[model samples]
Target chain A: MEEKNGATSKAGDWRSYERVLLPPVRDLHRLEVYEQNGGYEALREVLTSDKWDPTSVTNEVRNSGLRGRGGAGFLTGLKWTFMPPVDPNIPRFLCGNGDESEPGTFKDRQLMEFNPHLIFEGMLIASYAMSITTSYLYVRGEFADWISLMEVELAKAYEKGYVGKNVLGTDFSTDLVIHKGAGAYICGEESSLMISLEGERPYPRAKPPFPAQRGLWNYPTTINNVETLACVPLIINRGGEWFADLGSHRHPGPVLYGISGHVNRPGVYEYPTGMLITDLIYDVAKGMRGSKKLKAVVPGGSSTPILRADQIDGVTMDAETLRDAGSMMGTAGMLIMDEDTDIVSWLRRVTRFYHHESCGQCTPCREGTGWIENIVTRIDEGAGNLRDLDLLIDLCFQMEGRTVCALADAAAWPVRFTIERFRDEFEARCRPSLVPSGGVLTPALGP
Target chain B: MTDFIKDPVILMPERHPEPVFSTEELVFTAEETRQIATWVSQYPTADGAIMKVLWMAQEKFGFLPPEVIRLSAGALGMPYARAFGVATFYTQYFKSKKGRYVLDVCTCFSCQICGGYDMLHYLEEKLGAHAGETTDDGLFTIQEVECLGACGSAPMLQITNGPYVMNLTEEKIDALIDALKRDQLPFFSSVTLPQDEDDLGGNRRTDVRDTLTYSAPPVAKTLG
Candidate 1:
């Protein structure tokens, strides 16, 4: 058995890296098994021990080089530091985002549904570090099963004195509430999550008054991903130095990659932060479905730009490498597509999701997504002319970086990247079949 | 760059369930009010409990009506208009009365490739109702929505807004409809929540663990 060091990958074989969060054990969901496997031991140690203070916890996290496992890989400890000093009258909170709605992203759902106590334990330690008493775990509305599973686990935690006031007979206390989102993808965003939590529409709020400053009823709040918080207890149990040396120096720790789409075996896998794309796709996920030639991979979630197979041949699946390769490690979704996929039809299907999910708050996203959807649909159905292709490119540029939220940019990337990488396919599919005169299929200019 | 697509891109304009209106005021029973009171205690403010109040109102009333929204507002000590805003905004809350079972089939990118459309088409043929229409028998209403994050088990459906039976099949749908008609389905509430026992899915007990919970160790922990 490994010593379970957090720093420096003793992982001679990356496949067997430290299984801090997603340990491969059945019945680990049981409280007895979880406690036996060193679960909640960190939280108990932090609250009961004299050596580790709240500030020390924060500093350790900073040193660990942990980044947010949500779309944006922001430093986890740095995000905690953003919280304003505790105001006597004002309150602070830690929001655990369980609303995993990204199309190809199902990693959060795994943690929330299976080993839910990890999330609860992580939230308790996080709340303790920030000196906040209350934390809310927001699961997606459609994830009713997850909601139920969490409810059962939380009841166990409270009954055993892991959560609720005076956890484990310590001066520190914590309150964790489970919130079910009401079927909105935008609500996954931190501000939009706050809006939904407030019993309102889940529209992303503008920045400057970020959640760290004035969040959730105008108080300082830190919103962390389900995967991000799930890593906290593991980082706490082993020292920060141990965690920092676990993976890549820049973005350290284990990463949960959700592989779906055209994979022979589609499921979530956790690996050291800087594993190669080929290993994840071929070795870990068992290669493409039907053993077909790999065409493209959405290195991150569908939001990040797509990476053509050629570009990702030797690339590592980390934030920096994917970014350098014209993609991102957005949630590490890693959707696989085979050579037989119709790029045009795929783009049409992909673009329509953005259009349908647009919050209708920002002009560019509200209007631009619809435009892209219309044009792509026409092209896919052979109703578009050559003008539609250039028009699609123009629309992509206009919508990117032009919305109130990053969703517009996320909405724009796939459209631009799909066409950018597969222009020939889109062109080949362009033929006059059922060209609607004035609707989505309408040619922008004379054909 | 393209003025062509400037036209409105409304999605599933047909998905809007017609409002179920009644001149009579909507009210909750004593038990319903009592159960919701427990949730309200957990929230810092009454406003925060609106989702629970609305969910309970829907669970009890079958669908959220204008009167029920107003009634929920009163229960939560929130303005009726605010409750209306929330009920209207979310896709989960149905405005009109649906058939006894509302079939929400997911047609997102993940589900689409895995014969999700075939399931929708099959349901239309089986139930004699289109995607957004209720059957004349008042047994089922059908509609399509985006991803529910259950991609691993694609071609899934949330049976009448309860348990999500994934990796869907025609045979399963037939059995589900039969059980639903007979009010004999068990997994939606019993196993899914261990609370309601409303016949959606079975409860997950260590003594009776679901087949999905595997004995095989996860790949990451092996091969070290």
Candidate 2:
């Protein structure tokens, strides 16, 4: 086992790696196992150790620079601070964004499934911080097994007085409920998730109410992603400074990045902030797989713009730096694309996804996404001219910043940039493969 | 009380027992009840948001029957169609009773390339039912869904309402189905956080890459 920066990295073999990093924690979904492992020590620590003050906890988190580990890297402490100060008369809400609907992202489900107790513990601490009594984890509808696992964990937490009335003999009582979202990607968005939790179409509500001031029944609500809540336990257990020490000043703490595509090792790698994209690819991922040449990467998820191969070396794995590189780390979903990949076809595939998944609530996104898909499909299948590319770019431009939600923008940006970065590649896909295209003299539009 | 077994179990007498909505069945925690009440207040009238409430009720109980839907409508002061429209409009909203486990596979383009159909076929053979059908054992429900957004890890399937299992081969699919059949929970994949592909097929967990290690800190560690 190799250790870097006080964190373990098992790289010699898969078995060794899983053993050291993924060590099983006695199946603590049961109360007995959890208590044995010092499960609620943090809760106990927070409660009795200096009489846990909600403001203190919130202040520590704010200082630690823990950002939401969901798609958008919103500052977790800032989000916590957004909650209206403790209100006893009004019902306070803590929503767990289990609607893991972003494409290429299922880390939250894994967190809930394997270490559900961890998330439950996080919820307890968060509920403690917010002075909230009622909380709901809005899990994706399809995650029935995970929901059950969470229920079991909740029962365990309850048995140990981690939840339910008079938690850990503290007057700060909070109850956690598992709510399911009916299959909508928008539900993963905080406002939409709140709406969905209230049992409406999983669509984003206009901001300003923002779930902090008015959410989940028009009261103050604090919604954190499952991973965000999961991180809460770590923050509480180990002091905030320990978490701050893991990553850089910009984006502190360990981020579980889901690496996939043409890479030799494609899985979730939790690295601290300020890690290089080169290290993530070369050291962590062990380079590209097979004879495939590296092409571009969707640094975040499909929504993020593609980064050229040359762009990999110094690209910081944090959100702000990646945004500076012309792509937001929308979600830490690094989708690798080999040289053999056709950008035209891939873009079309993503366009089709956006079109299909469009909630139809917004017309520009609903129509523009479908239009881009049709044009891109024609281009990919050898039925398009240069005009089609211009038209596609135009459609993307229109959908970029005009929609009520970012869904449209998410679909549009990748297509626009893919065309810009690899225009010739897309154009190459245009001429029928058999049609000789002057011996593949490709052009690269300036980035 | 109803038995755990899914049979024509009698909750009522032979002739006709007035099915009473138990406090446990209809009632929720004060917080949950308040949530339901708040959702009801969203519409122009109290009855308008009744279907939304029914879906919420279904979410709480897993499935909704005509009785529950009607009860919800009555509770929310909505008409039957409005409530039924809410229940029946969304694909996730269950109308007729379904099997215990619902297997939703991504049959979209990306998954198709990665052998989604083959896996679907395998599931059909394994479950002894075609898509949109349930098995005679009444334990599994299989349906093909649009993309669940893990295109990076294609050929994915969500098992019996669990995480999306991706990077799928026949063997992995078989292992997953077997696990579900035995009522054992399967492994969870944290491929990435689904961001853009929100609604259609996002949030499904996929295959665990053999070499991929979750939770490696940013800096490489040197062991003594």
**TM-score versus the correct structure, for each prediction:** 0.88, 0.75
lDDT of 2 by residue, A375-419 (tens): 888887777766566667778878877876789998898889989
Off by over 4 Å in 1: A1-12, A431-447, B1-25, B186-209, B212-224
Q: What is residue A294's positional error in candidate 1, in angstroms?
A: 1.2
Per-residue lDDT of model 1, residues B16-35, tens digit only: 45546553637667887887
The model with the greatest TM-score is 1
lDDT of 2 by residue, B1-224 (tens): 56667786666656743444564576656786787676644332465345446666766766766667777777766676556645643567676557877788875543543356677887899779999998998888888876564544666777645566666667887787688778876655444322212222432223233221322111101100
TM-score (chain A) of candidate 1?
0.93
Minimal lDDT window, size 10, model 1 chain B: B215-224
Off by over 4 Å in 2: A1-31, A431-447, B1-90, B94-103, B107-154, B159-167, B170-224
Mind listing the fnat for each candidate? Answer: 0.40, 0.18
Task: Highest DockQ: give the candidate number.
Answer: 1
